[model samples]
Target: MRITLERSNLLKSLNHVHRVVERRNTIPILSNVLLRAEGASLAMKATDLDLEITEATPAMVEQAGATTVPAHLLYEIVRKLPDGAEVLLATTPDGATMTVASGRSKFSLQCLSEADFPDLTAGNFTHSFKLKASALKMLIDRTQFAISTEETRYYLNGIFLHTIESAGALKLRAVATDGHRLARADVEAPSGSEGMPGIIIPRKTVGELQKLVDNPELIVTVEVSDAKIRLTIGEIVMTSKLIDGTFPDYQRVIPQANDKEMRVDCQSFAQAVDRVSTISSERGRAVKLALNEGHLTLTVNNPDSGSATEEVAVGYDNDPMEIGFNAKYLLDITAQLSGDDAIFLLADAGSPTLVRDTAGDDALYVLMPMRV
Candidate 1:
């Protein structure tokens, strides 16, 4: 195989494909990326058995053929090439080595048989839809932070994606939780998204999907089945196996009757939490919230360290109350709020507290209070 392409184009395609290639591989073929140069395009594919990504870029194909080479090594070579330099790749007659050249520099890499690359099985999708890039980005950004890192509860290690009826309107929702905190967000379900099975998209897939939707101008075509998910954006196709675990009913955890309500500037509250938490070094990093009419005080106490307290003006008219929560959890939820004020609906000192953005109802967060 022989192809010529601009350095920048080849580097971008490599960066996209190499995310799935594991640095240390037990299998030899998995460490290499399959390169197919045919017609006017070069297709680069990489996989780690569970996740796979393919990116195609237009290139000047002199001799059309296919080969596999070290994914990261090739990427590094292309990245270090001078700007605007043209890269040339050619396979030796024996088909065991690939020669890469640009400017006055050249290198040879061992090539593996392309026929040995594993194919990702993406069966007939039960549901298909087209969604705006921005909408998909919002759905992921609002919930992914709360995904559980614990492997024992594998279901909670991913974002739960499903379609639900909200106020008689069909909405696509993403929910994630780790037992201590939860995040839920919804958007109008795209056409043809009906009857889609709820699926748990694993944490790695969510991170890789974010790269494909970073461009807001593109519309992503999503196909989902009980076992797999496929996302196509332009010349890039990403496929991953869904986690085969049951997600707990997150709806039951959200409180609907919390009466004590408080509204505070989101930025002010986040800053106060950050400042006060500096004093505590506990695993939970618990911070106590003291609330009264028109005022809120955030305090942190650590016997080994020190104590800190910060007062932030708020719009609280409820009875005096004190609630304790993990400082990092509070920061994560508040970072999702883009508006000026964040509304908190409290039940008491022991029950979970509900939080939302004052500007919109599309997203909600629940934090299980800790005992101070």
Candidate 2:
């Protein structure tokens, strides 16, 4: 196989596919990327059994053929090459070695047989829909931070996506939680996604997919089946197997009758949490929030370290309440709010507190309070 491709294009495609290739693999072929040249296009694929990424780039195909080469080594070689340099790749009939060339530099990399590479079979996808890139980005950014990392609760390690009817309108909702904090966001569902089954997208897949949705105008095509999901953005495609466990019912955990509501500037609240958390030790990053008529004060006291307190003006007319929460959790939830003010709904110091963006009710967060 022989082909010539632009260095920049090759590098960009490699950057996406190479990340899927594991540094240490039990199978030799898993460490290599499958490169196939056909007509005027070249396809690069890499996989780790659970997830696969494929990208296509325009190339001048001298001879249509396929071979496997070390993904990271090839990526590094092309990355160090001069700008706009043309990359020439050719494989021998035995498929034992791949020769790479650019200007005065040439390198030979050990290759594996293409037949040894694992092939991902995309099962029949029943539900397919399109979503705006910006909308998808919002869903991921808001909820991914709350995804659980505990391996035992495998189901909570991903974002839960499903279609729901709210206020006589169909909405697509994404929810994630780690038992301590939860993030939920919604967007108008596309017309055809009315009866789609809820799916838990794993954390690794979410991280990789988020990298492809930078363009606000680009529309992403998503295809989902019982076991796998495929996301298509531009010329790139990502396919992954969904977790086979049941996610806990999250609705029951959300507080329903929290009467105390306080509205504070998002920036000011975040700053106060940041300053108060500085005095908290590593074991317990707790901060106490004291609320009165129109004033909110944040306090943190650690036996090992010192203490800190900060005050911020807010709009609250409810009875004076005091609550304790993890400072990091508060900062993370506040960071997701796009507006100037954040609404905090509380039942009591022992009960979970709900947070929302003052701009709208489309997104909501629930954070479990800590005992000070």
Name every residue pair that clashes in candidate 2.
Answer: none
What shift in Å separates residue 66 of candidate 2 from its native position after superposition?
0.7
Off by over 4 Å in 1: none
Which prediction has the highest lDDT against the true structure?
Answer: 1
Model 1, range 1-372, lDDT digits (tens) per residue?
A: 999999999999999999799999999999999999999999999999889999999899999999999999999999899999999999999999999999999999999999998999888998999999999999999999999999999989899999999989999999999999999999999998887999999999999998779999899999999999999988899999999999999999999999999999999899999999988886759999999999999989998888999999999998999999999999999999988999999999999999999879999999999999
Off by over 4 Å in 2: none
Which residue window of length 10 is worst by lDDT in model 2? 190-199
Residue 185 Cα positional deviation in candidate 1, in Å, after optimal superposition: 0.6
TM-score for each of the candidates? 0.99, 0.98
lDDT of 2 by residue, 285-316 (tens): 99999999999989999998789999999999
Question: lDDT for model 1, on a 0 to 1 scale?
Answer: 0.94
TM-score, predicted candidate 1 vs. hidden true structure: 0.99
Backbone clash count, each prediction separately: 0, 0
Error (Å) of candidate 2 at residue 54 is 0.6
